[model samples]
Target: MAADHVDHHEHHPHGLAHQFEDMAQQKESVLLGMWSFLITEVLFFSGYFLTYLVYRTQYPVAFAEGSHELDITMGAFNTVVLILSSLTMAMAVHKSHEGSKNGTLGYLIATFILGGVFLCVKYVEYSAKFEHGLVPGLAWHPHGEHSPQLALFFSLYFGMTGMHALHMIIGAGLLIWLLVKTAKGTYTAEYNAPIEVFGLYWHFVDIVWIFLFPLLYLLGRH
Candidate 1:
């Protein structure tokens, strides 16, 4: 019994939680938890999306006019930046699997920088809207037909984009924490659950932006 216990202890991966039977089980548990959390997130965002669709159907022209007020060029640039961040995030997870600490750190830093860039672009866009007095219920002064409907469009725009930005901000905070852990060599081939789970979250954020870009920036632009 003593020898058997010693063997089992040796086989156990580093960082395995006491409650988990083994590394595989622990990884599965963490991944499932993250997926479950993401499902809730999807539901949360769905409300906004549904509202946008319903309102757009009722006020198509107003929505289009509001979309035109958006800087499509900046929106497109941020989309590309976010897509690149997703790539880097994936690469970081791959490096973690390989136990390449330096590789993981480099990619994670790149992802962080890209995320920052996206947020900065969003700040610029928001600043412009504020300056132009387009914020609904705050400084709304739209210069076109259907002023009231335009306010509705801006309301949805801020609500959706603001929520997206909040998620990005949270992701950025997570990245900073991950970067510190990664730099300290906390993750490795036998225990990279955090990195993998975070990758899923980061990818979800990017996918949200993919939907948002077309809806908020490209809609009715033709």
Candidate 2:
């Protein structure tokens, strides 16, 4: 009987760890770690954005032409998809807070599906560009004016968006892992650090897209 009690206590969410006095402390630590990581991500992407700004100012016409060639419809669709996923992710966190395990799992699944849809749209857009020889350094040619600057524009476009997509893939994988934990009944209202951390990551990805859409799609749309 004593052994069984110890086993149950070992698995108790409130038991947590020696380092954390309570679940709230654990959640706070996780949140701080995520913010630190995101700060580094911001610094990393800043280099690319600065480069884009420099070149866009130098060759405004070429940048405008290249931007116009992008499929704004697809970009807009992806933006919507990500925003919806962010909402679902936030709802999942809320469900966890309310101690609704099933609701949390459902929201996680919904967010994952939305993320998949966004990636599929991205694939279609990229493939279309490849077929049209719009890719940089590989059969790229400007039909109209500003042919030379098209390559530079394509370079920045692919680099920035490709990095963002990679981050999305990582975030989706993390959420899936969190969902698995949720299925195993590892979270409760008193202990949901994982869900909250995942929410922070989802929000960060959404914010990145908010900036990306305008810079890549709406450049000189006027």
Candidate 3:
């Protein structure tokens, strides 16, 4: 009976993994694995950015026009939204680390809500683009000499922003899971590895948008 009780308490107190003997080791391992995954993601996003640079250099006039079609106000607003979400996510991790279950849950909820707002803004932007016939291979009708180049620009535009939106969607879902777990008191000061890992992921997603905004929406505004 004592052994079973001890095992139950150990899991709660430390949240150890079968492969690790202690919480510290598990946290380090989990962070290493997450950082490795994030490094791969950075490379993946870099490929898209490189593509953008190549095509923009190849067709600066067309790129400028294409960038002008984007609503700078909306893009800037979403940028602020995402930045705020990252802040809240950081706070959530801090609260979780402090072992304040309600604080963690509140901040997670705030992060989740901010993420939803970003998606909603994205939806509006995409709808506006579709209405303007900005999409390629479906409704694009260029009014200038750079029609083909504009098509290429919009193609990369949709692809990159679309990929980023997908990441936000996934991140929001993960926040929901974290919110539930935090509410259940699954995370404590000693075992908040998952919260910390998810926080890093959230911050990464927002950083991608920070770059995307300037490239896609602010490039030709001047």
Q: Tens-digit lDDT track for model 2 on 140-177?
A: 75666677788888889899989999999998889888
Name the candidate, 1 or 2, with the larger TM-score value.
1
Q: Rank the candidates by lDDT, best first.
A: 1, 3, 2
lDDT at residue 152 of model 2 (Cα atoms): 89
TM-score to true structure, per model: 0.94, 0.91, 0.93
Ten contiguous residues with the weakest lDDT in model 3: 4-13
Which residue runs of candidate 2 sit more than 4 Å off their true CA positions? 1-15
Candidate 3 backbone collisions, by pair: none
lDDT of 1 by residue, 19-109 (tens): 8888888999999999999999999999999999999999999989988999999999999999999999999999999999999999999
Model 1 TM-score (2 dp): 0.94
The local lDDT score (0 to 100) that residue 149 gets in candidate 1 is: 92
The residue-by-residue lDDT of candidate 3 on 83-115, one tens digit each, is 999999999889888999999999999999999
Q: How close is candidate 2 to the true structure, as a TM-score?
A: 0.91
Pairs in steric clash, model 1: none
Cα misplacement distance, residue 65 of candidate 3 (Å) = 0.5
Relative to the true structure, how large is the alpha-carbon lDDT of every model? 0.94, 0.88, 0.90
